[model samples]
Target chain A: MAILELKDIHKSFQDNVVLDGINLSVNKGDIVGIVGPSGTGKSTLLRSINLLERPEQGEIRFEDITLNLPLKGKERKSVTALRKRIGMVFQKFYLFEHKTALQNVMEGLITVQKKPKKETEQIALDALEKVGLKAWKNHYPKHMSGGQQPRVAIARTLAMKPDIILLDEPTSALDPELVTEVLTTIKAIAEQGYTMLLVSHEMDFVSKISNRVLFLDGGKIIEDGTPEEVFRHPKSDRAKEFFDKMNKLKEPEFFI
Target chain B: MDTKFSDYFSVKLMWSRIPYLVKKIPITLELAGLAFLVSIVIGLLIAVIRYKKVKILSPIATAFLSLMRGTPMLIQLYVAYYGIPAILRIFNSWGANIDVNVIPKMVYAFFALGLYQAAFTSETFRAALESVDKGEIEAATAMGMTYGQVLRRIIVPEALENALPGICNSVIGLVKGTSLASTCGIIEITYQNQILAGRDYRYLEGYVALAIIYWIITIILEKIFKLVEKKFRIPEQPKTVEEV
Candidate 1:
């Protein structure tokens, strides 16, 4: 089933357009990998799905809710409801520096959902265990490794039990040595059939895990298909050029 | 100016007045404590108003801050205490039913001092709130928090932690500023010192005692803030986020 559908999404920053009339849909348990060069609105496209960057023109239909066109100003009630069902992992990790890893994951549950503390504590712990960070649950984000922090971030989202998660350059912020560990945790989550929209530079991992890969450039999706089809036989010249540059890009030097 | 330095500088006399000034310390503390609490309440409201840039109210909050920063505290106290009553009398002349005569002198002093504190602290709060990483806020919202939840669970806590040192400064400034209330007949520690000095003709000695007391209070406060600031410190490096 199409859990979330976006139609005619357009966004711009001043004269630089970011997303231009994006139309896409995510089905339940689908792992959609989005790949593009820097500054091509890959992150912006993902953010717009969560309404983090309000598109100038778009229609987002998630389950039964629909948000039409430009988001007036601040977030609306419907947007908040939509966001609850869609979590995001940022490139910067953006963990609350003051909160311990456990507290960080537990915060959204207690504050947003108002779940009882005792129950949420156990749930947060289970989420931490899933990311293999239950041992460091009491450690603050500032005290943890880059790989560990993103796993905790993933655990935070996992605890929220959102329908779909938007991972914006999830491993980009990690040191090369830590990338595989973070990716491993992500892979473990993907195995459980969590619907995810991933924006990533690690094409090998992207091509391996994603059932479908989207090639975006100049604020538009140039190609979208199963990894075998898109990576091996891209039709559009833009997607071909994008792949050419991506092929030439320096490989991430993971010291694993 | 002609008096000998030795004649006025008696450590014994200064020491004797400390006990006399000590009794009135509570009054000074109460005024500062109450005013500081009220100021934070007002300042948070004003800071959030200005931060969010609420339509007409943003300019109003800005104007209020400008007015407070522009005027001297002494002048503000005079207006609150002396000028308000005079304005009320003018209202009576215009056949208006208003009475500022019933208001207490301490109320005016408190009103002025609390407002003064707010003006200063509002900048601290606004800056702290702005200084929080924008990405953290987006992360909070993405996790399903509404604006109100994001504020209480995310923004306000971060702002307060960041604003701790500034809050300490504002608190100390307000405590020292309560000395101005002596002019309004509030009989706080400074007013008590004046009365004590009058009894023995020891102006310099009594003032010295007041200074020592204030110094000690400030030291105690600074120590407490140092402890809190230490606790509030974002860890420097036990383990780095970059190193696996």
Candidate 2:
């Protein structure tokens, strides 16, 4: 069964239609890559999945539960419960500047889970250890490199024990050399069976990590297939054009 | 004018009143300190109300802040010292019979200063609150902090850092403003000096003394505020994830 589903999702800002009649599904433990040219509602669609930016109209079902519709009283509690299980990582590393790297990771455990301070600290430390940031536990985000911060950000969400992680252009802000560290961390997490919905521009990384790749154009999915099928043979004209542009752009060394 | 100046220059006359005026410095400091505390509490509440924009309460807060800021501080002191007492007295005569003297001159000064300062302080707080990045707030909310927890844990600490310099300036402004309370019979440093000048005719010496006091207070407060600003500076750290 699909772990997450967006049915007939529609979104717009003012008169400009950003996403119209878009639908998607991600099965459990699947690494799904959403790729599109810039300004194709890629970011908008990602934000909508988390309900960060509310959809104008649609049904989002995460783990078999419908979202986006107004929840009343008891239903609100259930929606909040589901939210705690979904984690989001932003392109800019959105780490709390005021909090130390460990503290940022521990925050979800402490605040959302209401885990004991000592246990939360241990869990946070464990997550940071996985990201190789256990030594920088007390260091603030401003002091860290972009790649380090993004790793810490991922650690933060992971500390919450979320089943699904939504990554919004995770490596877009990193230095070329630093991108591997973050991408490697993400790849490790994907190998560990964490369902991830990634919006990224790295064609090589997209081809490697994604169990399924969805090609979006003009706010709609123009193509969807396994990485080999989509990258080697495009079914849609838009998908073909996108791959042509990707081929012209040089790949980073890690891809080789 | 020369004769008037000499009269003001009477060293003996001014020197005699120095101890009496000096004695009142504590009273002035106490009034300012109390008013500062009161203003912070009042300002915080007004800020919260205005920040939330709670129905009728927000409009009332809006009007109160507008009237407090729009009018002169001196006028506010008069209304607090005289107008409020007279109104209370009139109400007492109509059967309430409340003892107006229970509320001292210092109390009136506090109410005037705190209420007046709160208007400006709340605006400062509001602005400081706005300065916090919206993303941090969302992150905090996502972390499961309730609105109150976010305000206390995330919003307030950051806002205080942003609001500190403004608050420090206001405190100094409040200290200077305490001089207006002398008009209401609080007998603080400014009032005592003014009285000494009137009786001894050493206007220049008394006025000069007050100027020195204000100067000292400003210098001291400014240093304190600068230290506070330094302490709150955002920590800059080196990033992780060694170059791949």
Candidate 3:
């Protein structure tokens, strides 16, 4: 079942068209990995779904809500309602610097959801436990490792119980050695059956976690299929070349 | 015709004046404290107005910032002391009920000093507000926090942390600026020192005593701010993965 549908989404920054007439449908529990070269509008596509980029033209249908792009004042309430359902995790983690991990997770529940303090704390604690950071809940982002911080960020999103989680290059900002912890945390979340749209450069990790794969190139999804079909048998020359280059980078190199 | 340094600056006179000067310390602190409270309130207001680029108020805030920053603190004090009455008189002329005489010199001092400090502090606050990462704001927004909620919860707390050192600096400046309140006939420590000096022509002793008092106050304030900074300091992130 298509849980979220985006129809003819178009976004441009001045003369530069970042997303040109893109269309997509995401099913329930589908971990869709959006892989593309840098500046290929992969992040823009994900951001537009939450009305962050304000697509110049599009219509989004999720659950009973239909949000037309360039949202008018009356439709603004629906954007908030829409966002509550579609949570996003950023590349930079973006944890509130002044808050502890527990507080960061509790903030949305207290402020947006208007949940009671006692219940919010319990929910936040449980979310932190899921990310395997229950012990570090009192620690601030700066005190935690780069890998640990993103886990807190994921916990923050997970506590919100959004219908779909958008992970935009969630591990791209971390040091190579620190990437595994975040990826492992994400893989654990996927196993629990949360629908997620992930934009990532970690081709191997994406393939491992995602059931569906989307190959975006030049502001459009050129290929969308099952991981096995898209990863092994890319139809377009661009996807084939991109995969080839990505695969080449993965192999260890030595200089004598 | 060789006058000794003792004649110019009598240690005995300075010692004798200490008790009298100390009596006025509370008044000086009161002026600075009240002015600081006013500055913080107005400064944050102006900063938000400017930061948000509030349509009607933003330009006015910019003009006010320019006027305050461009002019001298003494002139602002003079303006508040003198101009307030002039304006009030005009209001009275138009049949408005106002008693300008009831307003105190200290109130004018507070008004002028607060307005002056607010100009500088607003910049401090605005810069701090801007320093909050856009990504964090987006994260809050993505979690469905409204604009007001984002500002209150995420932007404000983080900005306040960043603005603390700057605010401390402004406060020290404001404390020093309170000395100018004497110009408007507000009897603070400086004015008390001047009165003590006028009695015996011991200007050097009085000036030296005032300097020592202000220096000690500045040192105490610095120590207090250091403790506060330590208490609220966010731990520094490890620079490299090796450190992590």
Top-DockQ structure, candidate number: 1
DockQ of each candidate, alpha-carbon based:
0.54, 0.34, 0.41
Best lDDT among the predictions, by candidate number: 3
Candidate 3 lDDT tens digits, A70-107: 78889999998999888889999899988888899999
Q: Arrange candidates by TM-score, descending.
A: 1, 3, 2
Residue B53's C-alpha lDDT in candidate 3?
99
Question: Residue-wise lDDT of candidate 1 within A1-256, one digit each (tens)?
Answer: 9998999999999999999899998899999999987899999999998888889897999999888877655438888899888989899889998898989999989988889999999999999989988888778887887788899999999999989989999898777889999998889889899999999999999998899999898998988999988988999987887778777666665657
All candidates' chain B TM-scores are 0.91, 0.89, 0.93
The native-contact fraction of candidate 2 is 0.25
Global lDDT for candidate 3?
Answer: 0.91
Candidate 3: which stretches are off by over 4 Å? A175-177, A247-256, B1-4, B235-244
> Worst lDDT window (10 residues) for model 2 chain B?
B235-244
- State residue A220's C-alpha deviation in candidate 2, in Å: 2.6
After superposing candidate 2 on the true structure, give the runs of residues whose Cα lies further than 4 Å from its correct spot.
A68-79, A250-256, B1-7, B10-18, B48-62, B93-95, B235-244
Better of 2 and 3 by lDDT: 3
Fraction of the reference Cα-Cα interface contacts (below 8 Å) that each candidate reproduces: 0.76, 0.25, 0.67
lDDT for each candidate structure: 0.89, 0.83, 0.91
